[model samples]
Target: MTLHAHLTRTVARPLPITSVVIDDAFWSPRIEQGRTTTLPTQEHQLRTGGQFEALSLSWKPGDDNEPHIFWESDIAKWIEAASYSLAKRPDAELDASVDEAITLLAGAQQPDGYLNVYFTVVRPGERFTDLRDGHELYCAGHLMEAAAAHHGATGKTSLLTIARQYADLLIEQFAPGGPLEGGYDGHQEIELGLMRLAEATGDGRYRALARKMLEDRGTEPFYFEAEEQRRGTPGYFGFLFPDRAKLAERFREYNQSHAPVREQRDAVGHSVRAMYMYSAMADLAPQLDDDSMQAALAELWSSTTERKMYLTGGIGADPSIEGFAGDFDLPLHGAYAETCAAIGLVFWARRMAANTGEGRYIDVLERALFNGVLAGASAEGTHYFYGNPMLSRGDMTRNAWFGVACCPPNFARLVQSLETYAYAQTDDSAVINLYVSGAATFDFDGHALGLSVQSNYPWSGQVDVTVNTAPTVEKEIALRVPGWAQDVALRVAGEDHQVQVHEGYVRVRRTWRAGDVITLTFAIVPRITRARPEVDAAAGRVALERGPLVYCLEGVDNAGDVAQLSIGDGAALRDEWDDDLQAVRVSVDGTRHLNTSSSLYSSAKDSVEDATITAVPYYQWGNRGKSTMEIWIREDESASF
Candidate 1:
């Protein structure tokens, strides 16, 4: 089915607000804090010969690989966050600072439409030559995304125009008939950004270009082959090629070759690259009305959500490849569920929710937002974690920003742009994807509508939605019944309605009045979920889940080595109030078997015994002092004992 038709049937109204509007509260404080502290501190470090900047750009002469702009993904993230902030507060003074950065970008752009300070100023004449390591296109892609976002937020076209010109240069240089024909970025991103540009600007040419880029990849030998040959070795140095055929062949060999763009299952490659490709596929699949592509995306989505994803909806469990290692490879200590990857997952999942109008997508998105993405930032939102470890020891520390601290800014931008993902649209239907206290006003099919949703979600399960629309406009309202809500009930206009729940949504169509109120109540029961036996980490274990939040047992909260702890049978599960955590504490009655003499470096795995293990929402795991944690634990069967 075409995405248009699906959207038409699934969403019949317009989202009152875009993500750009929602993310401000989450983004502005961070920007203000950074402006006064983080940014200046880093700049001081750069100026005063601090180790961070020195180490970042150390690849230069007489120094180690010092902090290169592109080496740390944070540069792009800050740009993105600045774009978001500018969008939310166009008239504010901070916008001027953002404009200053944009001005820097403008000054940084070359006549050829290329804009990389490091490449153009620091190392000239080497453009596109170091495909194995250079991040030219990758940088361009991020800049393009920021440009589009800035344009979208402010209605000013200056940055976007610059980005457009840059894209034009790329098109002129790399189009099938152009100078750089038959090549694709080994670090894929421009394709997705270009597609987003097309959507933002209503330009078919950009979309066509994005499609062409996807189609053009992997056609020839690897784009990096020549560079690798020149370098006398082939290491995954980053940017490799633009050859569509060769890239497709490599993707096929890697088992990502699905029939259409969407069918490519399993995540692979540099975490960012895989996500960018998936994002592009998501964008193009619906626009082109390609079911095969959607199916392919669905396959990939299932692989990640079902078999590969962490409890936080974060992908990429392997630090070695900075990507997914394999199914069920989630090792707590070594797990590299990068914060940026989680942000990317949120990005992809949000698109899927829009495309399919399925609550499941939003469910996953919420999981990522509340846990994986939230974990990236501290409660105060200053310090950040680039890697969201499932389990953390006191040894784990939050860094200010890493050489690759792209995740923090990305988190900032996402938090700033979060409002848009909270709601979705169609001509006559509206679906509320999130339950946050907010009001939205938008026009749908010439009908003026206003929606106010008031609820404390994640912290509370009650959501109240009030709709005000044109008297003559009859609309359907679909409320997402989260997957974790096994027993959900909804009341409209104080009347009990017999509703059918399908695909995670309860659809209600009726004539609406201005003050009509719809209340949805989900039985947010705390339950234990057992993983399939094939999942090694989850063998003989079960994880706690409440609503959409996955619960874990942290050693700080539970007095035992989490790794050796096991839940005994016949233990009653009880909920106790913990004022310190401000959430319900789950207590399980089980015996705690102590292996006091076990050595830390023992070759033999510690034996598990019956014990009372209390688990809290995974989102709250790291709030206490860092300690061992476990999401899944053994469920004892000896209840009668």
Candidate 2:
């Protein structure tokens, strides 16, 4: 019995970049900025950061610069981002740079198809000896992903060839009956990368290898512990982690290897790694027809989104381990919502949507995309936020680059690949997952169907879609009804249409038409929302949400400090536009608790004064210089003075 013997999964297929064109008021400019500004800045950073130079295997131990074990992965991500940009709009200079990078990687690959700059140049002849600490397989995974993206964009096989060779080597070294059987990378990403390679090359070997690695994980005797004993040292990161016992005590679920994955219930460990692992599991569950894996995925999805996730769709509360803490332990002032983790959530959410054909996953995807993921990078697409805190005290700001620059490139890739997330299709139906203004062409049994969507989503819920199809094609066009919206109305050609809503989508079945117009409306309005009582940090506090954007009060916008502002019950809220931001802002009536008495332990009550609070979208915070910011506002118990 083998995992690969099961039937292949049937998931929704996304339209290719060639078949979809995104021309809209909101996403068009951002997509262009991703290609023009973000990609160039990342390339320059890679050159200066020694990522491109390290591929020559020239750095020494005592040199001014040392090659990092994870440097290759950074460059690999940039390559992937650039490849996506090139696919949409070809640029000669960008193509040349990609070619140069491929040349460097090709030169560095060993005869055995193994690739890693640190192990090759910094410590030769000691490869694959530190699976617990070293990131060799992780880097290989990124390379494989970059290779698939490059091949898909340019139809070039140079990087694909190198990726296949390295993948072959990995199968030999890590597969069952291999010398190093039962081995798994400490950081998960290769699983997703292997799945990408399998799709691109039509090779089942890569997918099987991913399954084998996943199945080998969390097995007894724990390969990492045994590998540490063999090395006779704590590990590379021994100083911070000390020993396995101390590491286990401090970080309860280290890398999510505490138990067999199918038996695991909670979402724990490194936030980014956990998301990657769960994403791969969601992808493989249907293909293998494993009901247990799907159930496990559902449990984890609830544990993550229902309890651990932030209002802005951010995850990972504790900064100490860059992972999740106890349920409902979300602290607004000190949050570790890494940018990569948000992107990982988007990936997993999309896969879950494909697995179940449900609209709830898409809701999470939209939340993360609009708030958490967009907040990671600045509007200009150059500066980035490594950790997005729910509350900022004039100290949190964007940086041009970081020592570990993983978030920038990861953000770039997701922004450039936005079109694929907007729409999906099957043999007899076309699904609109996101309300982005774009045009997508789908072919069903040699008949073509074209759909053009127009709207300013996350701002207005009025989506106007025009469908064009061949005379022979008569299929269903499904539009997703957002979970947050209310009083949804749908009309076909100016006539109110009554349709059955199933699984959060309104499915319309009709004969072929050339210019059939459909109007879907959901009144977008400002509302105040509160977290569960269990979330102690947000007790008696409410957050503002308009459409999909979460609004936050910044000191620059309201008074000089937002820490004392409290929203009274039945506060009047209105939407206004900020000239500087070119986006809608929220205005509300509140009270500010004034500091009166000077005595430290005085029992005197602080005087309250009426105040008008101005709030901007959470994603746009920190862009207008650092200032005090808070998402959850204190609630005033009394409505009348």
Candidate 3:
């Protein structure tokens, strides 16, 4: 099935606003200027000054044979950011810098279309020897994405041609009857990327190649075992793969056998790898019109969102592997909710939402974007956190980039792509996934439509939308009323309209004139959410949730073991301004229990009773001097007089 046919049948009309253009208003002088000013890092990395130079001086060509999974991932981010910037700014220096990068990339490409500095310059002979640990395919995937982005931003085909050569090499090396048939990257990303290349270049061969790679994963001989034996279990891949027998067992345990490309569920393995694999599955599912794949994807989505998810929509609860442990294992402080994993959650959610027209997918996406992804980057957009801890200590250090700093550039790229998730489309319908104060104009089904959405969302609940186009067409507009909204009202032309709501979206179909305004109001009620009893981390605890934002108690603002803090039953949550704090603060008649005992981990004494305590939004926590923090707190069962 073609993409257009699938969209016509399943997707709603009026495509969502994708961030094709750089958001200069929110990111311009502040964020863009910051990126440019940070160019010294890029220059240093490219030449001989910063960490890259330091590594390059000691770097032997053979050293590149070792798996440096993120060696090129960082550069891919910069290329994406540069393309986005040049698309919006069209500055001469930006163009020159882009051209220069392209020139370097072109020069670096091998005669066989291979283009990775590590493998090309560092270890040429051992290029495909270590598929289990090496990121050669992963790096190629990112290059393919960057090439597509560059081609889209500018009509230039230089980078595209270079990437095409690399893709050709991949096809030749990994095809069904090629030199390497049983080998697939332990990290699954190139499949989805190669598909994108196929779409961009209109090449059926690339799509076939991508399909072959996905289908060949986890078959016979098990690629990782041979690689591990060859390398004597050296470096990060050992940690990632651990025991070859165990890894193979887990693959079979997850039912990842040789059936079809889309019949797997329950996210497993490295958090990022699982998401990337699922993303490719989603992309290919619709293109192939595979119902089994869609069903499995839906099941996986539900499992993640309904049980194995943080309030912030961040997954991966197992700190050991930095991946999902099981259902409902969300621990606060010990959580290894890696920033890249959260961003990957958004990636999977957006693709599923776009493909299925399901509001639940967008709901998860919004929660992850506003909380999970936002927590990774500072409000200033300069500093970043590799691990997005729901609760933190003052001693916690934020790394510029970790041994796996793939999260940083991934975060930046997602922020740049934020505009795309706001809207979605089908033949005769449009779905608004996010409510932001912006406007989007696009072509769908041969009709030009303009939609203006004005709202102070995440701060306020009122969203007003105005639609304008040629007078003769009728279209169905779907507005998402968030699952958190308890009471929602929709009005068209000052008259209450009967709306059909399913899966968290209110659909209003009407034959539209040039000037039609549809207003939607979602009730933002501050409510307390409790985890299921099986979730030991949140047992006997309640967390405050308003809209999609999760609230937490920070020790800097609320004194002592935030675990023991409790609010009075009749305590009213009122919004108040704190001039010193410089943000909205929540006031509650809550009492703090002082742990009189010397032992830190002791349970609350029998003498403890209900007291007044205050709570604040989790995002606003840590602004003050960090002490202790807690998202899920024990609710005192006794009522206060």
How does each model score on lDDT?
A: 0.66, 0.87, 0.67
In model 1, which range of ten residues has the least summed lDDT?
Answer: 1-10
Candidate 3 TM-score over all chains jointly: 0.88
- RMSD (Cα, Å) of model 2: 1.6
Instruction: Give the per-residue lDDT of model 1 (tens digit) for 1-641.
Output: 11011111323222523431332232345445554554444433333433223322224545444435363234444556656555545446556656665665676677888766556545666666554356677777777787777777677787788788888887777766775665566667777777767766766667777777665554445555554565554333433444533664444323222223443566655565677778777777765544777787888888788888888887788786677777777776677888888888888887787778778988899888877887776655567777877665546756666656566667776765666777777766777777766676656656766777777566557778887554366777778888787557788988877767888888888888889888888777677677666667667777777766778888886775676666665555666657777667787865554555558665563454555668887766655656777777756676433
Better of 1 and 2 by TM-score: 2
Tens-digit lDDT track for model 2 on 1-641?
24242436556767777778898888899989988899899899999989999998888878977988899999899999999889989999999999999999999999999999999988888788787678888898899999999999999999999999999998888877887888888888899999899999988888888888887788787888778777787666765765557666333366777777888899988899899999988877888755898899999999999999999999999998899988998999999999999999999998898888898999999889888999999989999999999998899889999998889999988988887888888777788999889898988867888889999887888999998654464788889998888879999877898856788799887885878898999988899999999999999999999988999999988868899999888887899766788789999888899877888778888798889988899999988887999999999978633
Model 2, residue 196: C-alpha shift (Å)? 0.3
| Selected candidate, larger lDDT, 1 vs 2 | 2
**Which ranges of candidate 2 are over 4 A from the true structure?**
1-7, 246-252, 599-601
lDDT of 1 at 107: 63
Question: Candidate 3's residue-wise lDDT over 21-44, tens digit each?
Answer: 323233333346445643324443
Model 3 stretches astray by more than 4 angstroms? 1-69, 226-236, 239-261, 559-561, 568-571, 576-583, 600-614, 623-625
Best by TM-score: 2
2 against 3, candidate with superior TM-score:
2
**In terms of lDDT, which candidate is strongest?**
2
